[model samples]
Target: MLGASRMGAAPSASEEGEGEPPLTPSTCTFTRLVAKMAADKIVPVALELGGKSPMVVMGDADLKRAVAGAIAGMRFTRQGQSCTAASRIIVHRSLIDEFLAEMKAAVNAMVMGDPLDEATDIGTIISKQQFEKVKAYIKRGEADGGVAHSLSQVPTDPKLGEGYYVQPVIFTDLPSDSPVITEEIFGPVTALIPFDDYEEAVEIANSSEYGLGATIWTKDLKTAMNAVHRLEAGFVQVNQNLVVLPGLSYGGFKKSGIGKEASLEAMLDHFTHKKTIIINMT
Candidate 1:
């Protein structure tokens, strides 16, 4: 059975099992449960888990486009809930200020309110529990010496209801060890880490234990390619937001997952097995 990793309170493995080996792709915690069951039954399983994706902004990047891409990559869809969201932004020290300013303005301009409304750009958190969790992360970030910049004032619209709506946040002046920089907030929040040069930038981008997705923004083709090769993410994007299209192999490295989906790899893993049949016809 196909299962999602990131969603909370998923169906139990017993409920989904039909006497066959199960295929599960869920959170790291949930994967543990699935792994136990598979081990007990001696069946094969697949798992996909959490991420703390990073977007690297090089000194030579086009500030205007990079800022827009960062905002779009982090906030435009699902309020940064996806595993592939570029929640961590590592930028060159020289371009950090300009990138942050432009990113702040672009994020502030987002429309947050009723999701049913056509004009809404940002939506509410999935639940109250999720809202609180995200808020706690924000507070933890501040305590860790990261300065939080509120991108939007809480909307006063009565029509928005009592849903778990949260303002987007950007943390700056943070060390690479900050919780905001290291953990996956899974909210409309992003952190900026300044690097002195290309080597430092690449090092910081790969510092995370989660190697799901990463993006590189730079005008120099050589620099972009170098980062694309060096970043530890399973999927690396260059000069654009992280997006998964049809027919592409989708999965993460390290703790991200074990198998890919929606591509040839998925077909091979879940649909077919190779066998060799030989006969002494000669």
Candidate 2:
């Protein structure tokens, strides 16, 4: 029961921050304005920020489902330009070889062309700046000793040459601390990393500075439920990727952002301002 929905209260979104100075480039500008608003005893904020989300593939997971989840979770279908994109693929060491082989084939086969075309798998980067940023991130991944597998099909029509079309890319064998592994690369790029055990897998996935969204792939209900408890992301889905169901709240934790999005909780929890008035009957 939010006052906003029932009583005409204003709606504002800001991150839950600790009284610290804004540091992340992604949220600093808006954070400053939020701080100014707070100084005036005005709006309180709940921030829903960017994510370096992860997809964990257990050894017992269905390889096809896990690989398909990987492809979808990376947001490559949208040029990987989603804040909640699960860009980190943390696979069980036993499944890395097969996972990468399947992923490589799947990624390569996607046809990149006009968004208007029904057959096009994905389309252009939003702008020249973002286009270069995506390319730079790929290069940085290479410099960090990560091998990139670029999607083979590029949109090459002379008519559509002006579009900012960059093929999607997948990087493998990256170190845990590699920028490509740790930073938020908001492009059609993902990195494949491996871990030895369930504990290590959770550790790798939770290592992200941004805990926006995460997905775990497996057949075991026990593992899925266990992972749901252990993963640090705000939204952890099992056997699926990037799912936003009706009335389910979605948001980030840690540096990914704050507050909830798309649910009753957003109004009643984050955006609500409770007030009470009392008067004498005299």
Candidate 3:
């Protein structure tokens, strides 16, 4: 059976129902009996919700290095269909133009087509629904009066016609309140927000409702460390896209997501519970 809920509707009985078989005969009488199931028999569940992560470029950051890192952060792993994609870019006002130019060049060099094609740098999105969602955000960006810089025209291949594909799009001079800036587009769309100083940049980056992951690119150790302290994100990357080391914890704060995954720490947290042991040697 299929069940659907209207926007803002409260959870329904059907939605709350769990089909898992009861662990004991008496447990079946309870309204929600899944809690009584045996720990060893219970199936594990995981949720991978994406986020609107940002990249903050400090004033003293090397422009070449910042641009390279920013592009990699934004466009890495096929636009990071995963939850950790850096969709927003916050740069110092002085270097905004230079960074945008370099980013544009880098995106333009990407060859979008078949995922199996050795020459293809970017591939088609997962589904038509996702494609439409991404295209709607692109249209919203144009409607919100943000300048759209598309890197490549849509391909004419009939084989690719069966799937959804969109060119990489960048928006400049986006207002802080714009939907493109505020919402998670979950595609190859990036917005460049300019700030006059470090404090202002931190404010803009932390103002979002979602606080999953953030990136700070700078050559100065002090600036990177300071920004890391100020940013209110679960994962803070410094001058690189590989933020969480293997066997380290990975998760988000605020509305971006719940709980953690992707490391030994998360596995231990999920699998075990701590019990205080008290003993008195009198």
Candidate 4:
């Protein structure tokens, strides 16, 4: 039997006790049943977990609009804290100066402090470990000859420091294989890679190990549509910001992740089996 687990209230005994509550008999039985069924499966099971996502902005894009959208895509939802954030941004070489200038201005304007504060635009990292990991990436960026620009000075509050907090960081002129460019920082860190032309932009975007999602910004409808067809990512956004629509299937190609989620069609594919039925009553 396939059992779908739902999030419920915490066990009362665990809340009252000093030590954690032991797994209940029912939960233990369910775990064993799942293991046994998996062990006896006739076919191999495959799980496509997660990865680092990249966002590419072409030379033809409007610098102001693209930079603003890129900032939102990178920093939205507290850096997504997920596998799908726009971790790397590839812009055309000609637009690099304008793009970076606008991006830096936009990022510098973000308010970072108390999450509960209505004016706060940025929030803390998930944990101390995560904060350290992100900081290490910042160091790596500097060491790799990538310029580091912080959105704001690190907060001075001791209480805030106790929690995981990192200022948004942007690394510019990053080499293709640099850690800042190649690996998933998984924090509020982004790298700006410059390409020469449209062909080069598409090449750089597709060069990554993860092909989760991509955004194309172009005034020419033909070029935008061509990019939509050529990109390796599962989810492609043209002349718009990255967002989830109820009607669109969301997933990635290669190492980004597996299967699809969100859309009703994707959900149906995940939850239902298809069979071909034939009738010979003629």
Candidate 5:
């Protein structure tokens, strides 16, 4: 029920799980698995899948606030493990130096230790397997010609060093095609991609296979609106990090997934079906 390997039988609402029944099987999971179930006609799947979300920092952006927004988007609150995490930061070339410096400082200052401690900003990675996976991504990033800056330092104390802990890292000087910039690493790691102007920024953000969520930081209303019109992501945040509340649809476009969540449409998706009753009274 928890682990992917353990979740053998897909969740079914029907009393008898022998055959495919009329059920709404909503999932936010692996794309390949979803396709298999969909082909078998298991149910009308409402999938909310993966993301390689982006954060756009325009030349006119409020640098201070954008730094905060980028950090929050990367999920420093939970070590950047969220599906909607802003793994790619596309900033105007003019603002790259300032944005990167502030972002590095913000990540470096985060407290890393036991989650039970309120002061701790980041806890250990989910598990040793996940820990290794994230580490491998970091290595892959370096191999791809991305300059790495790690905020995580090996703790000197034996007790603090026991668990699967990794320092928050940011990669720069990588091309847009790098896997570290394109794939979902699902860790406290983000890639900084520099662009020349607004058009280039949108181009980089839209280039990803994922279109789940995105954020744009700019003081220019015109530029923000232009991005909103062009960026392919389902959920777009202007001047803020991604945050969804009740009554708002939360889902993605493209390979990111299908359908909606946390809104009335999601509830209706499962509860309602089309029924046509024709009666003629003569």
Candidate 6:
């Protein structure tokens, strides 16, 4: 029998954990370990797992501001290797062209170099295998009728040429239901699917199985408020995206995860237990 220590975390047995993922699985180890923890050990488990987050852009949204939010939300600096990356962009049909132009300029201006370098905007993919997987996804995105703007075009810098680095890519014109949009790529790739109205935008955003986070860009206060109520995600941002802090409980709805994280709720529920004591006054 694999002890809780072997799996590398025991919520009941351990001290307070800092805000970081306990495991970064290179294989099926995370899955196997989680199964053992929940099924066999029968202990408290709060899973903070995968996501395919969405960002919706209404026609009235400030393009420049929204584009900046999109870049920040994309996690391009981390090679888009984040669970909360809002990489699925559903833009207003009338604004797709303008959005694409701005996004291209934003991505082009980013500096991809050593992770430790202060000036570098982004770093390489985790490994050769992961790099190949991202490349394959880009190819599949094209096969699914999405037009790729930039396809893994590594920079000409001699220092960055030899490794698992890939440039950020944007795929436009794909259907809302395309696998590239539905699946979590976990790379610095985003898709642009156009919608005719706010209703369709919300519909498209809520269609994904994973609902970790979402962003809504609009100037209409009523529309933004409505979206805040309607969007099916644990974390919803209006007019901005991808802000994580200790005060906010981080987790996802549906298949994204099991419980809350990084807040008092998580600390009390998952990391601590409840006990009742009764005494008789004699």
The most accurate candidate by TM-score is 1
Query: Could you tell me the lDDT of residue 209 within candidate 6?
Result: 77
Mark the regions of model 5 whose C-alpha exceeds 4 Å error after superposition: 1-30, 38-42, 152-154
- CA-only RMSD, every prediction: 7.3, 8.4, 9.4, 9.0, 8.7, 8.6
Error of 6 at 226 (Å): 1.5
Q: What TM-score goes with each of the models?
A: 0.88, 0.86, 0.80, 0.80, 0.86, 0.85
Tens digits of lDDT, candidate 2, 193-227: 88889999999898877788898988899999999
Question: Whole-model lDDT, candidate 2?
Answer: 0.77
Model 6 residue 224 lDDT score: 93
Q: How many backbone clashes does candidate 6 have?
A: 0
Tell me the tens digit of each residue's lDDT in model 1 across 212-235. 789999889988878888999878
> 209-266 in candidate 3: lDDT tens per residue?
7777899988889988898888887888898865556766677666554456778767
Return the candidate ranking by TM-score, descending.
Answer: 1, 5, 2, 6, 4, 3
Q: How does model 4 fare in lDDT?
A: 0.68
Clashing residue pair totals per candidate (backbone < 3 A): 2, 7, 0, 0, 1, 0
Q: What pairs collide in candidate 4?
A: none
Q: So what's the TM-score on candidate 4?
A: 0.80
Per-residue lDDT, model 2, residue 29, is 47
Tens digits of lDDT, candidate 4, 56-93: 67767777888877877785447446556677787888
Worst 10 residues of 2 by lDDT: 1-10
